[model samples]
Target: MDYRIPRGTYDILPENSGKWQYVKDVFRRVAESFGYFEITTPVFEMAELFERSSGENSDVVQKEMYRFMDQKGRSFALRPEGTAPVVRAYVENHMDKSGSRNKLYYMGPMFRYDRPQAGRYRQFYQYGIEFIGSNHPYYDAEVIAIEMAYLKALGLQNVRLEINSVGCASCAKEYDLALQDYYRQFLPELCPDCQKRYETKPRRLLDCKVKTCQVFRTDAPSQLDYLDEDCREHFTQVRAYLDASGIKYLVNPAIVRGLDYYTNTAFELIVDALGAQKSIAGGGRYNALISQIGGKDTPAIGFAGGFERLLLALEKESIPLPGITLPKVYCIAIGDEAQMSMLPILSKLRQSGIYADYNPDKTSFKAQMKAADSSRAEFAIILGEDELKQGDFILKNLMTSEQERLSAEDLLQRLTQ
Candidate 1:
């Protein structure tokens, strides 16, 4: 019987949970500082929600989604990415219609049924932020700035910011046709997957990681050259905003996002050292997604970062986490009477907001001290029957080895002070 975790899923043991908390805490603080409010949607959404937004030709919809039928035969899908669900929520509630706007930050897991590898998983965690209801290119720059700030704070340096714009629907229609024609020329030479992409979604050929297919794509149509006037202006303004904010970026015309709903201001942040699957995070603008999902037209932009990839980044960079505790007091009780007697004292210490832990086992003195040492406690409270009667406890400074005998009330006051 192989009782093991399913493939593509992992258990986060105590050894690694600390780093998870560290990254999540820093992210929460930075998001709060930027005035991005927290938002969470269900882990699964209606199958149609993703299909419409991800496009029939996108890998997420075509082959990668973990879709299932409920007892009633209603189809549901574990989200492959974060932004589409967020957008669907924003539009369904008419959140983008009123005067006020919304900026949402989310952290959670997404599922994709692709072959798993290092830095890529079928069940993966993501941290995301979306600024909805505005087409302002400056908003895109601001989101990128926040992401950069988060990465910098984590001690990740020299990240590559690749920027691009796949023109809006009107221009995409024209470009799609042109792209379809170009790939048609090399159909016989393309690998099987790329040949499928050529007929259904030509833009996807640009995403082929295969060396042979990539060589053919080098001469493919550059979407940047074909951008409509509106997309061109939006992309330019986004770059200008990035420049004013001193965010370093390189414009790569090949960055058309995987989803059909995406439009304008596409960008990816990568680390070359993170192996062949290099992107740590990436996202872009989507305008028609809201309308596609039963709401009025609303503009939106957002990005998502992978948690496994982030942990890998930290390990690669040798970023250490302060995971162990530094309790204020470690109490050791000897004798059953003293162990029972110390209960009130421990309760009071907790009520006073002092970090205190005691062993109920009434263990031996030497073993107790070893436990205290591991706790890194500043002080040790030794309670024995003799000390309990005298209305005092053996209070020793773990660091100085200094001894003291003081009334319990007085000791509490001193410790609190």
Candidate 2:
């Protein structure tokens, strides 16, 4: 029987693993540079966590989340996003009581039941940052700076930053009323989903992709215009901090986070070359999320970026990424006895932190040399009957074709140096 990998997921083969690792390392370095420590959570959590944090009406919970019941009939779900689980851990572990701010980052796979497309997947990797215990607008800009610095480190040039404010609950309540008043006239022409969203989440109507629903969005109530005094001041401070940090951005009122928890500052990084899935990364403040999910009413902000889209953007811009590593040395032995002798030296070389490779199956000297060259090794250590008898090996520099006879101890010293 022939089996296939489930749709919407792809393997990170050896050829592509190096690139993944390189980007992950770059994100870690940038996050740490901003005083963010790493935090990891379970791949799956109690289903209610998301329903509460992301909102029951959010697309992720309603149409995309992978929900299941365990053998005990207890409902569970693979996390669709990273923020809620990190907040759950923080609250459960009492990180809030530590009397200091929590700047944390995480990287891992997120599961969703959405349609798979270019730069979109059922199982995709995400890197995110969460700044807890502060509503200070500086934390918002600082979190954004980490993502900007990471993209710069990866040499992505065509990405643009778009920022917005969703305002607080009171402001949202007023804005929702304005949205309803404006859309009530066109209710008959709205999509069924938007019709329901009219009463449930008016902000979601602005994000609808249907052409019919999109026509009304151009004149929809802008969230920025509805921002109250505190929210307006917060947005201004965030923009000021970004300016002081020398990060460029645009104020886009159309930016609404897909989740219900986001408030005040919302932003996304866009790459126009990516077409419909142009947003490479995005996040916003969730001041009420911790309290909504059973923690002290601590304020926090964060962002998450998908590695797949980020890599695709890098590709579109022709940015170079690390590839498969080649061995430093490849061993070739002409005979069985020589092959046996080469084994210990190969082990020694690897033990001394050298990337050494060998293939005992190839017995012909010519075939072994050809394999060594194909391996792209810097040096080829050749073991033949004559060299074995003389207690020495011939080290050939594959690039320079320079040959030198050296004792096994001497070869180790030379390679180590």
Candidate 3:
């Protein structure tokens, strides 16, 4: 029987996983530096949580969700996005009672049944944060700053920050009505998806990437024009904070993000290096989400970027990520007696914070040295019957081809230094 990796999933082999680790480390450092803590939820959750939080019309809920009924007749879904699951956890755990803002971040794999493409997958990794319990616009700016700072730290190039206000509930309602009236005339011209969105989610019509849809959406109503005074001011303050921090950005009117819960201050970090799916990171304020998912009214916002896409962007831009380091020492044991002696020294070297490895097989001397070289060790310690009796070993500097006789304690000291 021939088996293959599932359609939209890919493995992170040892050679490539280092870049992923580097990105995660950089993100974790930036997030913690800004006082954000980490939060992790299960890969699967009750399907209702996502359905309710993402809304019926959003693409995540309507399509791409990996929904299934378990043996107990309970429906569950692999998380297609990060924010909804995080919000569900916050509500179920009663995190709102803490009376302080919850600045939590996460990095993990998210499952979505997306059409597998160059930078997308069925099971892809995302790094994200959720800023909960704060209605302050500065929090919006801070969240944006965190994402921007993270990308900059990665040394990514030609990236752009596009900001927009999808408006508060009140103004968005008016904008929806306006969109309905305007698009109602051109419904015949829109794609079937946009045609449905005209009734279900009018804002998404402007976000459509269809060629035919774009033709009719040229003069589509801007959400900025309909922003209420409070919403307008909130967006202005977010931009001000970005400017003050010297984080360059553009105010894009067409950026109605792909979720129903978003309100005021939507932004995406775009990189042209990765073709049409240019969004490296994106998120915004969702003040009504807490209450919508059965919690007390709490304001929140956050952003997430796909790791597969992130690594792709970095590669396309020719940015260097931290590489995996080689073991500091490889111990070569020539005979059975030497092998037994080498084992304890290997453990001791590691215990003392030196990365060390050894070949356990009964191999020839030439084969053992070849193994040591293959292990990429900076130095090789050769233990033979003679050296085992002499109370010292031959330490060869793999890089310089220099050799010196050293006791076990001396070898550990030299390598650790």
Candidate 4:
């Protein structure tokens, strides 16, 4: 039988797991530093949770969702993104009953069925946060800053923050019509996806990556020009807060993002190291999403970044990340008798909190020593027939090449200290 991992998924082997840990640790630290606590939701939820939060016409629900009917004929979906699931959890738990602001962060794998690329996968890990209960523009800037701080901590030197405002639902209604009207003239020239979006979600036409669609969108209306007074004011304040924090940014009006829930403030963190798929992180304010998903009318804003892509960017920049710590001592047992005798000493060292390991294979002295060197142990202990009989062992400092005879008790004490 031919069996292998499903396409679009990869494993994190021991040799490279350290880099993942380092990036996750940095994200946790930065999130907590901003007064956010961690929250975890189930990996799968009722399909409608996403369908409603991300509009039914949006690409997430229309094309990329991994949804299926269970044995009971109930529709469920592997979470396509993080925000909708977080919002669903908030509503189900009635978190608003506390009357305190809910500042939560989540880090986990998100599933989306799409054409896999360098920085994207069907099952990929993401680090994101949700700030529910505040519509303040400062939170928008703060959310963006948290993402920026995390990337900077990971040693990304060239990161571009491109921000925009897509207006509120009220203003967007008119903008949507404007888009429909503008693109309707090019119906014959538009892609099939754009043609479908023309009637369902004309705003999406502006974000199409196709060459013909992009060229056709050159004269499309800008959402910034249509922002209502309140939306415009909110964007202005967000920029002011970012300026006061000394975070440099660009006001890019074309960045509508790939979701239907965003309103007013939208931003993306871009870096050229990844070529065409340069967006390392992005999100915006989704004030209407909670109410749309049957939650209280709470305002929320958040962002998510791919851990694999961030690590790739760090690698491209030649940045060093933390790795697993090597064993402190490698114990060598030369003969069958010595191998059995060395077990107790090895146990004692480990029980005392010293990282110690010995070869289970009873190999020759030379082969065991080579294994010790390859294990990257700082010290090597040899237990031979003579040493086992004498109640002493030879401890060799792998780095300094210093050797000394030490009793079992002495060896334990030396290694512990």
Candidate 5:
């Protein structure tokens, strides 16, 4: 028998660490560039909080939440999505009182108990944004643009952007009724879940993956046709912005988002090369969710990118490192006396914005030389007793395998150059 990580979990080893660092740096820079402030929230919240926001009928609340009874005998749950928690923070802090539209972003793990696959995880990470207190479709377009920018920044060329309008609560009411009426024609044929959806949330039937139920409703209504004057205007504006930015999108009427709270403007960025899990990110607007969860009524639109899926997409695209690399300097001390000399030099190098590394215990000349050779460093400052006595140091160019001896001040000037 062997001890091992549970199924669906993976250890990110050293080589993969570079990629992870890159994603973090890219996200921070891009989100800030778009004026999205960072918001850090707890991994778990009151069970009722998510239930109210995600909707009690959502798959997340009903089937997938990692819930438990806290020591106080109160129920809480590991968040399955980022928006609900962020909204809770926003409302609690009265963020709306200070800002017009609160733009926030978060990155962390979300727990789901579904059967795991290439893209799905029991405990998966997500990076997402929420734009609260803004109903204008321009924010919707901007959010889409930011997601596109992230994918483009990662050098992903094969990704596709899909968009849809599930209509507002009033409009969804109409669509849902229409869907139920249409699916009633195929009542005996729908899968078990679709059957449930037909009665509870018929719009979700459009998103059904079952082949038998996959048939588009013969008289299926497009929300576009039923959009009220306000929803219609907003959707048009969003399309205009996307067109001006030349962001390609598909108007997928069938794109009913997974969460029940989502109302209008559903979208996803998909990459298929990473088998099974084709979506890299997905989200939409929830115009009335604020009041639904006990906050002031505030309209909002946002999206969350799948962390595991995004990394997999990057792997397929071969994007370069995600952030600025470390400084190029190296430390090489030749003898016992010189090893002692490295301590102050290390302090100085760090203060001067150089990345320095050396092992005082690696006392052998061959071991030191091998270590420096394997460091992938750009330059090595070789300090030994004679060189120290001469008030000079030997500098070796790791790349060209060239060496030169110079006074300490001159060597600093040369290295700085």
Candidate 6:
């Protein structure tokens, strides 16, 4: 029987694994440099966690989320995003009480049942940063700076930053009312989803992707106009910080985080070369999320970026990443006695933290040499009847084709150097 991978998911084959590792390592280093530590959360959590945090009216809760009931009949969902679970952990672990700030980062697969497209997957890996316990707009810039630093480290150059202010709850209420008032005339012309969004979440009307609903967005009221004094001041400070940090950005009034928890600052990193799937990363502040999710009333901000889209952006810009790793030494043995002698030398090379490769099945001298060449090792340790009897092995430089005889001790010392 033949089996196939599920739709909207993919395998990271060995040929591509190095690139993944390189990017992940770069993100870890960059995030850590900014005083952020790593945090891990379960792949699935109670379904209501997202519904409450992302807003039941949001597309993630209403459609994209993967939900099911376990044998115990409790509803659970594969987390569609990262922030809610991190907030859940912070609250459950009492991290808030331990300190005035919690800077954390996470990278893992997020599941959503949306139609698969380029760089979009039902099971896609995401890297995110969450800065908790501060409403200060400086933290907003710092969080954004982490992403910017990560991209810069990866040598990505085609991306641009776009910022916006969604305002606090009070600001959102006024903006929602204005949106309803503005979109009310086009309610009949709206798509079924936009029509529902109009009544429950008018702010979402600005984010509607449907062509019919999009026509109304051009004339829709901007969220910036509705920002209250505090929200406006916070937005101003965030921009000032970004400016001081030498980070360039455009203030896009249309930028709105899809999640319901987001408030005040909102921003996205766009790679224009990727066309429709242009946004490589995005996030914003959620001052009320902690209290809403049963934690202390704390203010926090974060952003998440997809590895799939990130890799795509890198490729689009022709940025080179680490590829398949080559072996430092390839052991080629001829005759049973020589093969046995080669084992201890191979073992010592590996114990010394060297990448040494061997193939016992290729018994013939010709086949073993072919395998050694194919392995792409820098040096080939050739063990044959002559070398085995002489108590030394011939080290041949695969690249230069230079050969020399060395005792096992001398070989180890040379390779170590």
lDDT of 6 by residue, 119-147 (tens): 89999999999999889889999999999
Provide the lowest-lDDT 10-residue window in model 2: 93-102
The segments of candidate 4 whose C-alpha lies over 4 angstroms from its true place after superposition are 99-101
CA lDDT of each candidate?
0.85, 0.93, 0.87, 0.88, 0.82, 0.91
How do the predictions measure up, each by TM-score? Answer: 0.94, 0.98, 0.96, 0.94, 0.92, 0.97
The superposed Cα distance between candidate 4 and the true structure at residue 161, in angstroms, equals 0.7
Which residue pairs in candidate 6 have backbone atoms (N, alpha carbon, C) closer than 3 angstroms, thus clashing? none
Question: Global lDDT for candidate 6?
Answer: 0.91
Q: Tell me the alpha-carbon RMSD of every candidate.
A: 2.0, 1.2, 1.6, 2.0, 2.4, 1.3
Off by over 4 Å in 2: 99-101
lDDT of 1 by residue, 266-328 (tens): 889998889887899998887777788777877888899988887787778888865655689
Say which candidate scores most in lDDT: 2
Specify the highest-TM-score model's number. 2
What's each prediction's clash count?
0, 0, 0, 0, 1, 0
Instruction: Return the lDDT, model 4, position 133.
Output: 85
Candidate closer to the true structure by lDDT (higher is better), 2 or 5: 2
For model 5, residues 345-366, the per-residue Cα lDDT tens digits are: 6677777878877867677667
Query: Lowest summed lDDT over 10 consecutive residues: which window, candidate 4?
Result: 255-264
TM-score of 4: 0.94
Show pairs that collide, candidate 3: none
- Local accuracy of candidate 4 as per-residue lDDT tens digits, 1-417: 999988899998898888888888899999999999899989999998888878786778889999999999999999988998888878888888776448889999999899988888999999998998889999999999899888877779988999999889988988998888788779999889888888877888888888988997678888888888999999999999999999999999888855666788888989897998888888889988899888878888998888888888888888988788799999999888888888899999899888897887749889999999999999999998899899899999999989999999899899998
lDDT of 3 by residue, 1-417 (tens): 999999999888888777878889999999999999999999999999888988875678888899999999999999988888898888888787766448899989999988988888899999998999888888988999998889889888788999999988898899999999899888888899888888887888887889889887779888899988999888888888788888889989988866666899888989887888989889899988888989888889899988888888888888877677789898898888888888888888898888888777737889989999888899999988889899898999999999999998898788777
How does candidate 2 score on lDDT?
A: 0.93
Report lDDT (Cα) of residue 171, candidate 2.
93
- Model 6, residue 158: C-alpha shift (Å): 1.1
